[model samples]
Target: MASGNDMKMAEETYSGFIGLVKWGTILTAVVAVIVVLLIA
Candidate 1:
């Protein structure tokens, strides 16, 4: 019961952390591309 909920919460937090990293990398790549275009 409590352990199950704790496990679920831990998984959710890990996934959220991964999602933030993935999106952050993507956002940085996109901004870099835009800057390159502007420079060119």
Candidate 2:
């Protein structure tokens, strides 16, 4: 029972981490493009 709960928690955390990274990368790319446009 404890192991099952732990597995669920880990899976949630992993998914949350992936979500953050996905959004973070997208945001970073957008900001970079904006900066380049402004500089140009």
Best by TM-score: 2
User: Worst 10-residue stretch by lDDT in candidate 1?
Assistant: 1-10
Model 2 has a clash total of 0
Q: Candidate 1, residues 1-40: lDDT per residue as tens digits?
A: 5698899999999999999999999999999999999999
Model 1 TM-score (2 dp): 0.75
Q: For model 1, how many clashes?
A: 0
Q: Which ten-residue region of model 2 has the weakest summed lDDT? A: 1-10
- Write down the lDDT that model 2 would get: 0.97
| lDDT of each candidate versus the true structure | 0.97, 0.97
Tell me the TM-score of each prediction against the true structure.
0.75, 0.92
Residue pairs in collision within model 2:
none
What tens digits encode model 2's per-residue C-alpha lDDT throughout 1-40? 5598899999999999999999999999999999999999
Q: Give the clashing residue pairs of candidate 1, or none.
A: none
